[model samples]
Target chain A: MFDVLTRILRTGICSEPLPRIETEQAANLQQRIWAVLGRALCIRQVDAGSCNGCELELHALNNPYYNLEGAGIKFVASPRHADLLLVTGPVSVNMEEALLRAYEAVPHPKLVVALGDCAACGGIFGESYATRGGVSRVLPVDRVVNGCPPAPPDILRAILEAAQGKRQALAAATAT
Target chain B: MAEFNATPDFSGAFANAGALPSNVPCRLIETSREQWLRVAEALRAAEGMLLALWGHDERDGGQGFLVYASYLTAQGLLVARLCLRNGDERFPSLARLFPCAVRMERALHDLLGVASDQDDERGWLRHFGWPREFFPLRGENRLQTSFPPTPEPYPFVSVEGEGVHEIAVGPIHAGIIEPGHFRFSVVGEKVLRLEERLGYTHKGAAKRFQTLSLAAGHRLAARLCGDSSVAYAWAYCAALEALSATVVPPRALWLRALALEHERLANHLGDLGALGNDAGFAVGLTQFSRLKEDLLRLNQAALGARYLFNFVQPGGVECDLDPKWATDLPRFYSHLDTELEQMRSIYDEHAGLQDRFRGAGVLSTATARRLGALGLAARASAIPLDLRVDYAIAPYDRMRTKIVTQDAGDVAARVVVRFQECLEAMRLCQRLLEQLPSGDIHSAPRVAPSGALATGIIEGWRGPVMVALQAGPSQSIRHCHVHDPSWQNWPLLEYAILGNIVPDFPLINKSFNLAYSGQDG
Candidate 1:
């Protein structure tokens, strides 16, 4: 009865942003709170030639757990409308040309976020003849989020950071 | 052997299509451009779709290189081989006959520096970043150099109108995803055209196959696309097994089907969650994602790899379902059923999800068939070609499946098919577990008999994955091609996104869910 009542209460409360706020506070610092709450961002995604593991996590951002739009960020289908380009995969041979073309297509004032180890410097799949090691080889990267395919929460945090433009500074200043 | 009497007289049928001279028995048809059209027409009469088209450097007594085309028929396989001498690279383009032929020709041009009058000048598969004139697959030019130089400006087509600004997304995405370029010509909220440029995930796995032993080759297949490892491995093994004529044990066959369906279920679960989230339905996403995670955990526990790598080897399976899987499967099914019902309600009752999914990214049956869309997308759009059904392979044939379909071929129909297939898969898993047979898990696969060729097709989670293997001068892999259905459907994604609002592209893309890694290879 308590679980049922809690679920009903929770579902109702979800519409008001409290549950998401509760979850967001745990993952982000108090200073970063306004970063997520204040802005709705359009994301542009790039893939050098990833294994699609990162895609799985990217797909998760839209799921109820991360509900990025609920947090005020949206994934715009094209780069011209995008505020950020999220990159996954190590750049591969066939994709090198296409990747650069896509980067050039996006409008100015756009932020670039590298989403995985492959994007950073050629994760496990880097050594193959098909890849060029990392996405940075193909395009400029402003922020790096490391993981095989970072968890949905981590991706959401990266987007939030891009939206706020605050968390990357912390990582850089801390020198971690 | 009386089997010798069954061989058809190629002189009468393919003689006009460039049947080679008597001395060149190893070489088949050297089809001319005019002959390619005739050959395609003839093969169409035999009911075969053009599987793939690509070039290989000349080897052994074989001259310059060969361009190959494959046709599938109920009786057996038919291959049309066109030899392209190094300097004389011109060949008739089959793109006019088969729409999917355009991209294959472009890939040939990009990789081998080979061109044909049939080439699609739209640059469907050309490199935008790499040196423009330098072809990667030409054997003499294997060295990586910075000089050939990428094209200075990519020439993607744009739409011009008031409020029509172009939006380009990716080669690099913010999320952990494979690289592909999505160019949207949009007017405020409305999308006029969506052009997708992929092939960033190309690993040259097909080219590397020549160096790999059959055992190691399976590893390469599994890595072609990570998520569909089992399907790729199975397809590769199937080609090798058919070439070798190895008879796999029945129990192993059943288990293979079970694993394939399990793979299908895992992807569908994850997709369902994502699709829901695309609709702005958080509750559905949360529930389905939790469900998908549970399924992944189950996969990790059952197979050493969550994606079921190396579990499938040529001739038989590498691992058996543990005793725990048999026991735990029922409970898992029940859990899945409960969660599925919950999701169904959310999808059914929710108004927003319907608005996003109903008619968005619609790919009609005609368009899907014309584009050669394979797998569930094709099936959902009413293209009744399931390898398990059409080919009637073991386990799938015996354990009948009511093919799930929806003619709408829109995003909603895809979701409906996916959701329905999930339920059916769960039921099938339950049945397979109950009817589990007792037998050895592995079998000794056959070594190829000399001068044999075979093709294997498996309906992977994504679509029909076809792998063709031909035995070379010494029973080695002479030439091979791995065909992902993405080859057919990725082009269709451009059409599906047309007229959809820009914001709906993700929902549309996720609905088709083609793989860049597999297709690029």
Candidate 2:
């Protein structure tokens, strides 16, 4: 127990301050994030058929440095609990049905973020007999983070943007 | 009867007929249909492990279809090719000798119209989108096609008993991970049998290779499994280099080694943390994750990418090690050593972590050997088949690679191996950095001789990542088969989980952490 404490003390807190995403919506995100998602944001990641580059970076968000959970966002096991679907990969034909089922399972006012170059636009494994291009080809993707795999900070930014964008869209519909 | 003696002889072609003591591998041996059976029996007796078994259509060349099997023995590597005429696409089965060949043969049936005489003909990679008659790899099929969905469910083997029930998981898992299905037959909490249905991530990499130039194929190869980007890229490059007869600069070779070691370190660190998290130890996750992040940060600062995707190319590595990297790399190495040591001791001493780790999902050495387990998992089970040490491929010949093994073959053993390997990787990187040669870090690229075949096998973090490249006309690729070590290790995961509780499945699975997209190719 003493050793654990010592190790923890030595490691210190590694989490950096939240990234400054340069956008009109992101500038006001800090003030309204809590209001938009109530208490926390729950994301369900569906890997359509990635090489797993994006998934690794997504996982990094949970580490002490990114501390995604500390910032009131966590990944859930079921799509039923999710406010957004964090999808990756180029959407292989084998995974198309399951992806749709997961998309359907998410509750109303859902946000979908395609998480890599493959999900945004089939990066290397393009539109083939096996792949259906990207996530947009199947479902309505609101945002796309485009690197071979965008960095963790970029992903965190996208998540915040997606949440804020969806909340505003719902408001617009009600006013109309 | 002249069997493959394994003394690799490399001339203009990979001459398998002659016997010579050479390090250059993928020694090609063309055998008759009848001779292939004899060769399989001989290789089995000689304790030669089948590295890869892939089938390709040669109808474009006015020949029939051909199946190639590459074997690694104590002597060297031998690639045996067997031909089947147009209509006669049947070949003898090697599943009796190497049980790992079952999945390969099944995939061969789906891709090319060739099959071994094995009873289990259930389609492995052929899902609803593929028609029964359409062989996608027959040189004339349009790959822009995906068939309509069919109403057929996969026949997963069931354990029928009084209390036997089933738990089905994923083509899309709950975790932020790759897709593959796992069917566990359990009685209450204890699992009786576990059968996996992979190939869900199959994006037809073999077919994609045909459309690429030999130079550009490494980009696709690097993403075979993004985690082992260095391994797949290196394998593809090595094969391309051999075919084109380009000797990479000594500095480039050293840099490649450095990148490969860093890749190994990054994966081991991540797996250790994930294993700890699985065992309900959050502290382990934090420390190791922090370590991995720091390493990746260094990679971005040095190699221009966090994942090292385009860092390794055909003739050599992409960028030379800058002076800033030379200083910062050593600093990072020392930091990793001290932090990793503290975490290793904590994991070793923690009774709760040990309790969950030890004796859970034990894959015996016998079972591992029989199933042809490779790389980290095989090493965990006390099988000393590291290609770096045994095959002495390139820079490994100079690094004085050490083989680390554990007797227990459980999750604990795998963890121990990971911890020790992380340190070993640091040691190797330090050596490569210290003795980094002063020369060009790349070579001039050239078109490979058409129809010439060769194999490049690298001891990747997971296992031996093998690339068998048969060049086409001009700069194009004829047939490229990329083989991941997960092919051998995934079957062993099924055996490892038997008799263990279903709750412990994730822990054991993380310990092995086999690749889906990599093996799907």
Candidate 3:
């Protein structure tokens, strides 16, 4: 316990900035997220046949530097409880059905973010005997984070953008 | 123990043993189908572990189909090539001798149409989407762009007798990890059996390799398994270099070692943190994760990418070490060394962690040996089957690598190995960066001639990642077989889970953390 306290004290808080509450862009992020989701954002990450480059970045979001949960955004176990479906990979045929099921299970007015080059646009493993090519082919994606895997900051920005986009879509629907 | 160090004694029906172009001495035997089983039998008797088994369609070259079985023996590396004539596509299965060959044979059948004469005809990589008629690897077949997936019932051997219930977990798991299904048969919380149905992430990496040039293929190999990206990239580069007989600059080799060690350190730190989290220790995750992030930041500063993807290239590294890394890396390492020691003591004295870790999910050395998981998986179980030590090449050959071994084959032992290996890797990395040779970081790219065959085997974080490349005419790749050590160790997890509770499954699984993408392809 003494060792733990000493270490913790030395470490201090490592969470980078909550920027305008964020990478790539962070303006009006925290307020926008709160106004939209009310309390927090629940993401269900679906790896639709990724090289796992994107997955590593996604995991990094939880690390102290990114502190995704600290920003009131967290990954849930089930799609049923999720507001956003964060998908990665080129959507292999084997994973196609699973991706669709997860998409369908997510509560309505859901936002989808394609998290890597492969997920955004069949990065390398293009249309072949196995892969179906990109997340947009099967699901409606609001934001596509590009890179071999867009850095964690970029991933967070994509997530925030996805939430903002969904809230706008919801507002437009109600106004109409 | 010394027997494993000796090259395989292939003394029987196969007298003609030639060598393949590789950093390590690898004898090759291309013989008739009749001697296929005999070759495996010889190697098995000689205590050789099957390295990789792959079948490629060479009918375009006016020859019959060929299946190659690479084995790591006492001698070094030995590759056995089985030739199946045009009309005859059946070859005897190595599954009888090497149980690990079962999945390889099934996957070979799925990708290339060569049928392994094995009783377990169940599909390995083939879910309903891939029809039996369409063999993706065989370039001759005119395939439809998309095959709409259909459901096919997989026969998971059911457990019986009162109160034995089964739990099915998915291809879309609960975490930010690659997709694969897990079927757990349990009586209450006690797990009876754990059978994995992988290949959900088969992005046709092998099939896609056929479409890439000898130069562009390393990029794809790097992604074969994301976590072990550098190792795969280096292995692919090593194979291409071997085929072309390109002597990579000494500095380039040292830099490649730097990237590989960074990869090793990063993975170990990540896993150690996760293991702590799995054991309900939040502080472990926070501290180790912070340390990993620091290392990743250093990697980005030094190597250009956080994950070190595409950092290794054919005959060289993609980037030169940034000069600032000298003080920056050492400072980071010093901080890490101190922090790691503190964390280790905290973990060691924490009774809760010790109780959960001590006897949970044990895999015996004998079982690991019998099952042919003598490399990465066996290392923790007091078996030193490290490729860096056994088949030392390049920087590893020079660095006198420290191979950490633990007698207990439990999660605790694996954790211990990770901690020790991380420190050793740090020391090696420091040496590599400090004494980085004065020369070009890469050699001039030379195209490997057509029909050149070579294998590159490296000790990845998970286990040995082997890439076997057959050069096609004018820089085209005929076949590139990427073998992950996960193939041998994933099954070991099934044994590791037996008698352990279902609740502890995640911790055990995390400890081994087999690559689904690497093995699936």
Clashes of each: 24, 0, 7
Ranking by DockQ: 2, 3, 1
lDDT of candidate 3? 0.85
What are the RMSDs of all candidates, in order?
6.7, 2.9, 3.2
* Tens-place lDDT digits, model 1, residues B278-320: 7887556666776776676577687655567678887788788
Superposing every Cα of model 1 onto the true structure, what RMSD results? 6.7
Better of 1 and 2 by lDDT: 2
The digit string of per-residue lDDT tens for model 3 on B271-341 reads 89999999999999988888888888878878998988889988898889767777888888888898888
TM-score of chain A of each: 0.71, 0.91, 0.90
Expressed between 0 and 1, the share of native interface contacts present in candidate 3 is: 0.85
Winner of 1 and 3 under DockQ: 3
lDDT for A122 (candidate 1)? 74
Question: Under CAPRI classification, how is model 1 graded?
Answer: acceptable
Docking class of 2: high
lDDT score of residue B361 within candidate 1: 86
- Residues B238-274, model 2: lDDT tens digits: 8888888888888988988889998999999998999
Kindly report which residue stretches of model 1 are placed more than 4 angstroms away from their true locations once superposed.
A1-46, A57-88, A93-130, A134-176, B1-35, B45-47, B72-77, B122-124, B143-149, B158-165, B449-452, B471-476
Please report the interface RMSD of model 1 to 1 decimal.
5.2
DockQ for candidate 1: 0.29
